[model samples]
Target: MNSLKTNYNIVIVLFVSIFSFQTNAQSAAVDQLHQLYIQTINTGDPGNLNTLYTDNVSIRNSDGSLLTGLNNVKKQYQATFDNGKYDITLKTIEEQDLNEDYMFVSGSFVFTKIDEPEAVQRGTFVNILKNIDGEWKIYKSYRYPEITNIKSIVDGLYKSFAQGDIPSVLEAMDEEIIWNEAEGNAYADGNPYIGPEAVLKGVFERVGAEHEYFKLDDIELHEMSNNQVLATLRYDAKVKETGKTYNAQVAHLWTIRDGKVSAFQQYVDTKKLNDAMSK
Candidate 1:
């Protein structure tokens, strides 16, 4: 059994070494291909863009539009460049080889119209490249726009809370966060919690101490204009003091800025909570 285990380990090491060598050997080609693509964007010239793709390429645009054939893809890119000048940044997320002739590269990108820097767009992309006549070319491409910052940030906070990762939940808030509970709610005595530390002490700590279990239920995030997200949910909890359970309807209005939550206003069915707390 020990000899068998040793052989298995050797096989695994050899497999990894071979894969690493193959990847390293192909890295230069992939980098050159990406640089060529970037050069096309930099020059706003789609004339040479087709050289980066296979003749029968297909593109799945972020807007749900599709273009087939290298010529069609080149035309679409030309049309985009005609609209306005853009500055784009790309980041490679992962790359994997599907045998020797084909591989997939996935990455994220941020692009902005040079004239309107505030209107930045971010998305992720995938390129399936095939080796055609000793040259790597894109066989297929896909782009997906990133979700709005407000909803994404707020969603992450709720996820952290559900996982009992209190530090992460707090870290999402800005240093000067202003938090408020509904006026009639018992927690409102500390209305306008000024910062993360205050929120940790006055709200989260109290909630943990006063409840057997507390959960956010049926959370639906609505993206609002001007960097805010409205979350409709329910507070499901059992009060430790009275041993009574309550599932109160709740809503949270969160204002986010620079990827951190700057303000929070919570609306809850306070009467149900009061009844649960009372003997």
Candidate 2:
């Protein structure tokens, strides 16, 4: 009976050893795959890259466009290489093994134009890898720029404001954001609010104090060049002192950089605002 118990313990120990070995091997393979990808991008060579992805794999680009199939993915990469050479770097933020056959990996990447290293683009990516014939291959992939979606970022800010998420609204602004109100508007007294704190105290707070209910209407975001977004909207507000409502046409030109609003210039019908505030 003691001999049988000893054998059983040995079997358990062997099982644990085998499991640990498998886990370590999987981790090493995944790391190697990422390294290969970086090397391929830097060299502009598709060497063994076809083996990195599944035949039916799909990749989502920063602009929300999808590239389906391995051949198309390869062509896309070649096309990108044709346009310009880039030095790409990837860092894995998180990884999870979903099962024996699948894993999820997410990370951030920086792409620097080889000829112009100063021109760098930062983004995050997600990859779903499937194990086929003991080899892990990307089954699905997604990548998005950190600062490219100017219109979406502005839209999100407005949505946050509508939801009364003041903190989120302020968080979207850059540290040195140059905020300006329409020249003759009351808020212009504190034009060029230097930072988030200044804008919060000088503009947002004052607006909140002077209005019974303030809201934006008819917001149309226009994607402009030079990292700028032009928002054409109407300010719908009721002044607390005069109990009068004003729907003033307004235009906001927002300059964005590094995923933050760097500058804001407001153009509004100042006469409407002045009339609304007059008792």
Candidate 3:
């Protein structure tokens, strides 16, 4: 009886020891992943970022745009660099473990205009990291603009428009769309268009008619309330009528309902668009 009791105690001790070691190992892995993410953003190196991301990582932009794969991530950073003037700083606020292999990290980012010290913008980012092959990599990333700025959503919308994926583009809107443009002095009155058909006819059709190719240069998305999103975007487009090129800035207000865009309103620099088309 005494020998059996001793053996049982030994087994219990071994089990506890194993459990503790595993918990510690997992914690260390999560810390390493957090560090890797911070380092990648600070270095602005795609390779470094890739080291902490899966090949098919999913990036969720503040404006609800989803970018998958390392190539897409690289392209996004390249676009920012090409624009010629931006700086980014990231801070991790919290982390939660979903499982042994999955964790979520939330943080804030401050973007500064390289040319204008006073012009600084801040946002939030949430990233999900997974452990694969004994390494922690970012499996997903989501960014949300601070309440005061909404450029990310605008960027995603314009990119969708340019890609001719109006359905994916419209999915980001609220139900009662509020459309406005800077150049045309045009306000799409009365909640604008709801559903895909109205979006296809009113916005996509009009823009597609004049521009042969449209590309978004930058986008920023800001979270205003639990359900409200604001976005600002800059785009370069080629006019089919005259083969002219124009860069325009646009803004949008979006309200989300039931995990779908319920309403959307857009504002664009019409003068810039018109001038490019005329030229």
**Which parts of model 2 have CA positions greater than 4 angstroms off?**
1-5, 147-152, 155-279
TM-score of each: 0.50, 0.55, 0.50
TM-score of 2: 0.55
Model 1 alpha-carbon drift over 4 Å, by segment: 1-19, 150-279
The top-ranked prediction according to lDDT is: 2
> Per-residue CA lDDT of candidate 2, range 143-225, in tens?
87787578998999999999989999998887789999989999999987999999999999999999999999999999999
Model 3, span 139-227: residue lDDT tens = 98887766542445555666776687777776666444544334353224323455556666766676678778877666777787766
Whole-model lDDT per candidate:
0.88, 0.90, 0.70
RMSD of each: 14.8, 12.7, 12.3
lDDT value, residue 263 of candidate 1:
97
The parts of candidate 3 lying over 4 Å away from their true place are 1-24, 85-87, 149-279
Q: What is the alpha-carbon lDDT of model 3 when measured against the actual structure?
A: 0.70
Ranking by TM-score: 2, 1, 3
Candidate 1 clashing pairs, residues 3+ apart or interchain: none
